[model samples]
Target: MYMNTLRKRSFQIYADHIRPYKGRVFLSWIFLLFAQIIGLVPPLLYKRFVNILSSGTSMDTDISMLVRIILLVVVVYIVMNICYRIAEYVVVHYVARIMADLNQTCFAYLHRHSHQFFSNNFAGALVKKVNRFVNSFRVLFDSFYWDLHGVVVRIIVATCVLAFLNIWLGVILFVWSILFIFVAFLFIKKKLVWDVQKADQDSVVTGVLADTIANETNVKFFVGSSREYARFETETRTQQYLQERSWMVNYWLNVAQGVLLLLVEFCMMYYAVQLWRQGLLTIGDFVLIQSYMFAIIAHVWDVSHIMRRLYEGFADAEEMAEIFETPHEIVDVKRATTLVVPRGEIVFDDVSFQYHATRTIIEQFNLTILPGQRVALVGHSGAGKSTIVKLLLRSHDVTAGKLMIDNQKISHVTLESLWQHVSYVPQDPILFHRTLMENIRYGKPDATDEEVMEAARLAHAHEFIESFPEKYDTYVGERGVKLSGGERQRVAIARAILKNSPILILDEATSSLDSESERLIQDALQNLMKKKTVIVVAHRLSTVMSMDRILVIEEGKIVEDGSHKQLLRKKNGFYKKLWNIQAGTFIM
Candidate 1:
C-alpha cells in the first residue's frame, strides 16, 4: 500500500512537471548509467590480481607480469574516475534546473489561491513548505540516478558473472538480495512513521517562532514576553524530542542492515570454498566469488538507503501537494476579456455575501454610484464596509447577485485587467522592505524617478522624504516599520497617485494622521480625486461630509443614503448621530 501511494504521487509529479524536462532527464540517465557500467570494471579486475598473486609465488617471470598487471589496473581506475566526474557535473546542473522549475510552479499555483487561503496560513510556514518541496525532489532525483540505476547495474553485473561461474552460486546470490531488501523494507516502514512526526513538529516550531517575532511589539506592550517565551520553549522541547526519537529508529535499522550484509558475505565465501575443494571451481573463480559479494553488498546499501530517503522526501512533497490541490476559488470564465471601464461607473445589483457559515455580513445589498462621482460609506466596525471594498476588488466574490463595472460582470473579466482599472489604499497601507522610491514605483514600475517624486509631492510625502539624508533612496524597514503611521499612509497615497486608475477606493486612508496632517492630506486627496470615481470609507465625519453622497449601513442593510445636510434633517438618523458626535454639536 505504501509503495502504491508513493508510485501514484511520484507518477503524478512526473506527468505534470517532469515531462517538460525531457532533454535533461535523458542526459542525466545516460551519464549515470555510463559511469556505473565503467565502475563495475574494477571489481572484476581485482579478481585477476588475486589470482595472479596466489599463483605467482613459484613462477620465475611472475615479478614482471605483476608489474604489468598493476599498471593495467591503475589505467582502468583512472579512466573510471574521469567518467564519474563528468557524469556528476551534468547530473548536478540538470538537477538544479528541474528543481527550479518545480519551485516556480509551486509559487505560481500558491499565489493564485483565494484570499481565504492566505488569510488562514502563516507566511513563514508556506515559504518553508515550498522550499522543502523543491529540496525533496532534488534528493529524490539523486537517489534515483545513483541508487536505483547504479545499484541495479551493479547487481545485474554480479549476477551474470556468478551464473557464468556456476548456476548454484547465482541462485544463492539472488535469494540473498531479496531477503536483505525485504528485511530493510520492514524496518524502514517503522522508521517512516517517526519521520512524519518529526516533520509535523518542525512545522509547529517554525510557525511559533515566526508568529512570536512578527508580534514582538505587541508582546512588549502587553508585558507578555515571559508568556511568549514559555510557549516557544514548550514547542521547541517537543520538536527536539521528536528528532531524537526519529534518529534512534533509523540507527536500529542500520544495525539490522549491517547484520544482513555479514550473513550474505559469510555464506557466499563458504560456498565458494566448498566448490574449490571439490575441484568444481578454479582459484580465480573463488576470488571472483569473493570480490563480487563485496561489490553486491556495497550496492545493496546504496539502494536500500536511497529508497528510505525517497520515502521521507515523498512525505515532504505530500504537504506541498495539499496546497496545490486546492483549485483557484475565483477564476475567470472561458474567453474572459479585459474590462473596459471608460465611464468608471460601479453598481452592485442586489449583492449578498457571508463568510463560511457565519451570519450574513451583507444581505440583498444594492448600491450605485454614477460616473466620476464621489461617495462615502459610513458605518460601525463589522458593518460589512470592508467586505464591500473587497468585493469591489473581487478579492472575494459575492454569494449572490452581480457586481458590474461599465456593464462588464466582475466575474467575467480577467482579474489582472479588472485590478488594473482600480487603485486601492488599504487601511494599514502595507509597504515592502525597500527604498522609498522603489515602494512608490511599485504602483507604476516603469515610472521614472521624476514621476515618483511628482506623485510624492502631490501626496504631501515629498517634504518629509526630502528631510532624510538619502532623500528618495531611503530604505523603509519591513512592512514600513521605519516610517511613522502618517508617513506610510502618504507613501501609499503617492503610490495610488502614480497608478492614476479610473476608480479609487480609500479605506480609512487618513485615520492615522493628526488634525494638522489630516487637513493637509485632505487637500492632496481632493486633487487626486478629480475626474475619478472615488469611494471613501471613514470613521471621522469631516472626511464624509464633503462627499457628494453618504451611505449609512447597519445590520447588513443600508439604513440611510443621501447628502449629509439632507440626512441630518432627520433628528434620529444614524448618520446625523455620528456627525453630531464628531463635531460635538447637532447640525440644523
Candidate 2:
C-alpha cells in the first residue's frame, strides 16, 4: 500500500517538473539498456573463453578465431562504458534542470501567501523547507535511476537469460527476489519515521539561525546573546541525537540485508554446480551461472539500499508538498474588476475584525472619510488603531461589514487595483538591499532616475542621499540597516511621495525622526497631503493637532470626533483628555 502511494507521489513530482524532459529521459533509458546488454555480453565472452580452453587446439577451427573472440569482447566493453557515462551525463543534467524549476515554483507559491500566513510562520523555516525540497531530488534521482531502475532492469534480463537456459533456476531466482523486496519494503516503512523527524529537526535549526540573524541588533541591545546561543544549542543537540539514531538503525538494516544476499547466492551456486555434474550444463554454462549469482547478490544489496533511501527522500519532499497544498486565505473573487478611486473617499460601516475567535480587536466599527480630508486616529496602544488601517488595506477582510473605496467594495476588487490607489509610510522603515534609486522607484517601478530624484527632493531626502559617494546609486544594506533612523524614514517618505496615490496612510511616519528632521518631514508631508485623502495614526499628539478632523478612538469605537479645537472643547471627551495629557496638563 505504501509503495502505491509512493509511486503516485513520485508520478506527481515527475508530472509537475520532469514531464517536459521525457524525451531526454527516454533517450537516457535507451542508452542504459544498451549498456546493460553490453554488460551481459562480458559473462558470455568469458564463458566462450572457458569453452575454447576446455577443448583441444584441434577442436577449434583455428587460433585466429580465438583472437577474434577476445578482441570482440574488448571492443564491446569499451563501448558499454561509453554508453553508461552518456546516460549518467544526460540524466544528471535533467535532474538539475527539474530541481531548478521546482524551486522556482515553490518560491512563487510562497511569495503569494497572505500577510497573516507569514506572521504565523518563520521566514527562515520556510527558506529551509524550500532548500530541502529542492535538494531532495538529488538523493531521490540517484536512488531512482542508479539503483531502483538499474536493479530492476538487471533482474529482468538476468532472469530471462537463466530461464532460457533452465526453467528451475529462473523460478528460484524470481521467488527469492520477491521475498527480498518484500522484506526491504517493510524496513523502509519504519525508516520513514526517522526521515521525517530529521527533516523537521533540520528546519528547526535553520529557523533558529534565521531568527537570530533577523534580530541580532535587538539581542545585542539587551545583552541576550549568550541566552540566544543556549537556545540554539539546545535545538542543535536534539538534531544531533536524531542523526545518531538514524545512522545506527540504517547500519543494522544494512547488516540484515547483507545476510539475505549471502543466502540467495549460495543456493544459486549449489544448483549450477549440481547441474554441471549431471551433464545438463557445459563448463561454459557453469561459469555463466556462477557469474550471474554474484551479479544477483550485488543487485539485491543495491536495490535494498536504494529503496529505503528513495522512500526516505519521498517523505522529506512530501513535507514541502503539504505546504504547497495549503490554500491561500485571500483570493480574488471571480470576475473581480479593478477599483478606481478617483475621489479618494473611504467608508467602513459596522466593520468588525478579530485575529482569534475568543478575542476581538474591533467591534462594530463605523467611520467615513470624505474626499481630500486629513483624519487622525489617536488612542493608546492596543485600542484597535492599526487594525483599522489593515482592514482598509484588506490585509485581512472585515468579518461583519463592508469597506469601500469610491463606492466599490475593497474585497470585490482586484488586490493590485486596490493597492494602486493607496500609499503607506509605516512606523518602521522598510527597504530592500538594493540601490537607493531602485528603492525610491519601487513606488512606481518604471520611474526614470530624474523622477526618482524629484520625489526624493520633495520628501526632503535628496540632500542626504546625494551626500553619499554613490548618491542615488548607493547600495542600502539589508532593510536599510546602513542608513540612520531619520534617513531611512525620509527614504520611505520619498518612496511614498513617488507613489502619489489618492489615499495615504502615515502610520507614525515621523516617529523615528528628531524634532528638526520631523519639522522638515512635516513640511514635505503638508505639500504631499494637499488635496489627498489622508489617514494618520499617531502616538505623539503633536503630529495630528493640525488635522482637519481628529478621531479619538477607544476600544474600536469613535469616542470623540471633530476638528482639533472642536473636540478639545467637549468637557468630558476622550480627545480633550489625551490632548491635555500631551500638553502636560490634566482635565477632569
Candidate achieving the largest lDDT: 2
Clashing pairs in 2: none
- The top-ranked prediction according to TM-score is 1
Runs in model 2 with CA error above 4 Å? Answer: 1-14, 59-62, 85-94, 584-588
Q: After best superposition, candidate 2 residue 30: deviation in angstroms?
A: 3.1
lDDT of 1 by residue, 378-415 (tens): 99998888899999998899999999999899999999
lDDT of 2 by residue, 1-588 (tens): 654554466458657788899999899989988897678777787788788878677644746667888899999989999999999899888988998998898888887778898998888888877886777778887787767777777778778888988888988888888878877777777776777788788888888898899999899999989999999999999999888877777777787777877877888778877888888888888788778778876787777678777877776777677676678877788999999988999999889887766678888888999999999998989888888998888888887888899899999999888888999999998799999999999999999889999999988899999899999989999889899988999999999999999999999998898878887778799999998999999988888878999888888888888998898889998877777777862111
Itemize residue pairs with steric clashes in candidate 1: none
TM agreement with the true structure for every prediction: 0.94, 0.93
After TM-score superposition, the amount by which residue 304's alpha carbon in candidate 1 deviates from its true location, in angstroms, is 4.0
**Position 26, candidate 1: lDDT:** 80
